[model samples]
Target: MQKLLIIDDNDEVRRQLKWGLSKGGYELTFARDGVEGLNMFKKQEPSVVTLDLGLPPHENGVEEGLRCLGEMLRINPLSKIIVITGNEEHGAALKAVQGGAYDYYKKPIDLNELKIIIDRAMYLQTLEQENQDLRDSSVADCGIVGECGTMQEVFTLIDRVAASDVPVLITGESGTGKELVARAIHAKGPRADKDMVCINCGAIPENLLESELFGHEKGAFTGANRTVKGKVEYAEKGTLFLDEIGEMPMSLQVKLLRFLQEMVITRVGGRRDIEVDVRIIAATNVDIQEAMQNGTFREDLFYRIGVVNIVLPPLRDRGADIALLANYFLKRVSAGAGSRGKAFSPEALEYINGYDWPGNIRELENRVKRAVIMATGPQIEPDDLGINGGDVLRQRLHANDLSLKEARMLLERDMVEDALKRESGNIVKAAASIGVSRPTFYDLMKKHGVRNA
Candidate 1:
């Protein structure tokens, strides 16, 4: 249940508030003055607080209330304090809000209006709490890194669905850590004790795909000299990660659909049906909708595997995470090799932030690895990362012919990327250079999948 603390000097007003707000589903507590209010606030750690501007020490002024408000917020910076002031105390009310109160309410309180504000405050508090918890968990266990708001939503989703049996379909471009997400889900789930078998559906030959999924009996095929357990059998009571599931053959998809329906499988050239319990996690770089429309992927299989879709953003979309990941990879690649304390030069970092990473994290990691080994100096230069400043402009201009819309979008992306680089990845400076509000510039950066330095 939510907690609300009411700090007021008048007993009658506090009583009325407690009675009215009881129906709002919060556990109410009261304090008579600023000192008592801060004490109760520290003790209760309430989600929302109603602070009266006139306390006993400075009953006619806002100083005591404002001091209490600052102290309460210092204890828990996320606290939502709603300051209550007299009808004529507009300046004090506004000042209270400026002093870190979530909002301010004038006296002669209408219960309904105050209830609505309190409800919104509590909701916002809940969301921020959940987001922080998700971020903490992501840092500790997810093995994924990024602090973008969109990535926070993804982290929250992962935490919510990790323990369930529902199939998860991860859609993203290549090198976006889809496999890492799959492993994180399996690791955080109830089936972590069991094996998590993985197979690259696109890497195998069409003829061997079926046999690889389900076990084969001796003499089942031309070279079937001995019986062997397939990936599905090996992953009993665990998860089966189908990487590049969109590339799975339609004929094999039919068989997979049957297995999903019956929870049983048949070995090649074997009549007996073997029951298996395994969760499915499918990932694809291709658009499954287009695959289904083209009849290359079965609709039934798609539905069975795509119950919870977690779409991973490409590396370019993860703002500021580029520098974090680059620095992390730099330390790792240099530590094991001969180099020591290798780092990216300022020019290399600018190039990293400005360039569009078509190959995502894998590409970033590979370039960093090559640079660590190839760099003659302590710092890796842009040339070491295989990037040329002017060459980038030339390459963009001469690459495949683009439509007018595509060309405009490309130019927009480049401009934002350049702004971010020029500002040393400072969001405010970059947005100023673009002649747009900070939020609108952020939206554009997100739209163009631009990451900060």
Candidate 2:
């Protein structure tokens, strides 16, 4: 049952409320003063609270009541506290709201009207709690979150390629999760039971890379004290994820190409050739076509590795996926860190959607992680995110040389998203906020492909 706490100083008024709310189906508790009421609030932890503005120690004023209200909110910002005041106390009521009260009620309370207000407050509180719980429990698909059309196509391609042994070359900008794609393919492929060995071509020293790829025999070099299997041999009958393959030196590229063709490798000081059965999955943030043009990458090796390609779109171009990913990261990081439930302010969301994410997913995760730690309130403002809303539009305009029509469309889409967010996903209120008819708002939403909240 939902808990409700009623705080009032008048014996007559408390009696009247008790009679009116007895059949409201609530687990109700009552107190005659701010001190007693606050104690009950802390002990019972009620979801909805009705606080009378005239309590003892200031039974004729709202000062004591407001102080109690502030304390209750401080203890639990999600709690719903409704202030009950007199008809002439409109200013005090507004002040209560500004101080974080959920809503205000006037004196001479009618049982039916008060019950309706109480019911609405209970419903909103439940809704917010359910949402927070859902976010806490929700999981992303395959450790990835994407709902846009382009991402759907990418998902389809990943499934198709995971069923084959053909080499897959994943291309994307840095921080765009190229390695994640490779791992997903390996995880879903026929070699799922086998180990998926990974090596970054650029991260290793050039002189040692060849040795690392093809194991060396005992006495092969000063440090080669014993025979060891290289990545290929270790990944036998599995997958070898060669990250930053474009960074491999030309000499090593020839060796890799030879291994791909013959499925055999000779140790550095051994004459016998060993055959290994392994699938290759390469990833690079560089442009292989440009590298090949400059004599840095080999065309023959490209064909050997790029039998199939999966290109990941950058965060900025992924449409609504940007917000989807931001929320996913927020939930994931918040749950893991054991932080209080929180959400992004509408302005902060606007900035997030408008800003150009040059660093893509990695940057977004880092920002959200930091904001989770830095935020002091229930809502993460743009300042907490280290973003300036005013600068977002300017940065976007300068980053993309958009046409006049494209710019207008961008603004329209942003306005539509911002209105929906500010209005708490209420379609009617969102439409009214932007001075548009509901049908027109729906049309604009459809044109921009903005999903309903």
**Model 1: which residue pairs collide?**
none
Judge candidate 2 against the unseen true structure and give its global Cα lDDT, from 0 to 1: 0.86
Best by TM-score: 2
Candidate 1, 80-124: lDDT as tens digits: 999999987899888878778999998899999999999999987
Runs with alpha carbons beyond 4 Å of true place in candidate 1 = 1-138, 393-453
Report, for all candidates in order, the number of backbone clashes.
0, 0
TM-score of 1: 0.58
TM-score for all predictions? 0.58, 0.61
Give me candidate 2's TM-score against the actual structure: 0.61
lDDT of 2 by residue, 1-453 (tens): 999999988889889989989889899899989889989999999999999998889877889999999999999888999899988789999999999999998988888998898998997797678556544432223476676787777878888999999999999999988888888888888998999999999999998998889889999989889998888899999999999999999999999999999999987888899999999999999999999999999999999999998889999998887887888788778879986558887657777888788889999999999889878757886656775444566566787755575477568778988999999889999999999999999867654546676
The per-model lDDT (C-alpha) reads 0.84, 0.86
Model 1's lDDT to the true fold? Answer: 0.84
